[model samples]
Target: MSRLLLSTLVVVVVIVVVVVVVVVVVGVVGVGVVVVVKVVAAAVVEENDYVWKNGNHAEKTYLFLVTNTLT
Candidate 1:
C-alpha cells in the first residue's frame, strides 16, 4: 500500500511539473508574437507616411508642368 501511494505521488508531481513548463513556454511565445506584430505595424505605418508624402510631391510637380505649358 505504501508503494502504491508513492507511485501516485510521483505521477502527480510529474504532471504538475509538465503543466508548469508548458504554460511558461506558451507565455514566452505569446510575448514574442506580440512584439513582432508591433514592430511590423510600425514599419507599415512608416511606409504609408512615406508614400503619402511622395504622392503630394508628385501632385505639385504635375501642377507646375501644367502651368508652365499654358504660359
Candidate 2:
C-alpha cells in the first residue's frame, strides 16, 4: 500500500513539472516571435545594417546632425 502511494505521488509530481515546463517553453517562444517580428520590421525600414559591433540597434532613434564645432 505504501509503495503504491509513493508511486502515485511521484507520478503526480512529474505531471505538474511537465505542465510547468510546457508553459514556460510556450511563453519563451511567444516572446521570441514578437522580438523577431519587430527586428525584421525595423530592418526593413532602416537603411544602415545594424548590429552590436556597429553601435547600432533596432530600437535606437536616428539623430540628424545640424552643426559641428572643432577647436
Candidate 3:
C-alpha cells in the first residue's frame, strides 16, 4: 500500500510540472505576437507620408510632401 501511494504521488508531480511548462510556453508565444502587431502598427503611424496600399499586388497612388522644423 505504501509503494502504491508513492507511485501515485510521482505521477501527480510529473503531470503538474508538464502543465506548468505548457502554460509558460503558451504565454510567451502570446506576448511575442502582441509585440509584433504593435511594431507594425507603429511603423504605419510613423511613415504616414508614404502611400497606403489596400492590396498586396499593386500600388494605387503616390504622396509628396515637404516639411521643415528646427527645435
Q: Candidates' lDDT values, in order? A: 0.83, 0.68, 0.69
Better of 2 and 3 by lDDT: 3
**On residues 1-71, what C-alpha lDDT tens digit does candidate 2 reach at each position?**
99999999999999999999999999999999999999987875463334223644442333222112211
TM-score of each: 0.72, 0.56, 0.65
CA lDDT, candidate 2, residue 21: 100
Residue 20, model 3: Cα distance from true site in angstroms: 0.2
Tell me the tens digit of each residue's lDDT in model 1 across 1-71.
99999999999999999999999999999999999999997996676566656758776576557657976
- CA RMSD of each candidate after superposition: 10.9, 9.9, 9.3
Least well predicted 10-residue stretch by lDDT in candidate 2: 62-71
Which is the winner by TM-score between candidate 1 and candidate 2? 1
Best by lDDT: 1
Q: How close is candidate 2 to the true structure, as a TM-score?
A: 0.56
Clashes by residue pair, model 1:
none
* Candidate closer to the true structure by TM-score (higher is better), 2 or 3: 3
Model 3 stretches with alpha carbons more than 4 Å out: 49-71
Q: Candidate 3 on 1-71: residue-level lDDT in tens? A: 99999999999999999999999999999999999999997886566434343422233222222222211
lDDT of 1 at 51: 61
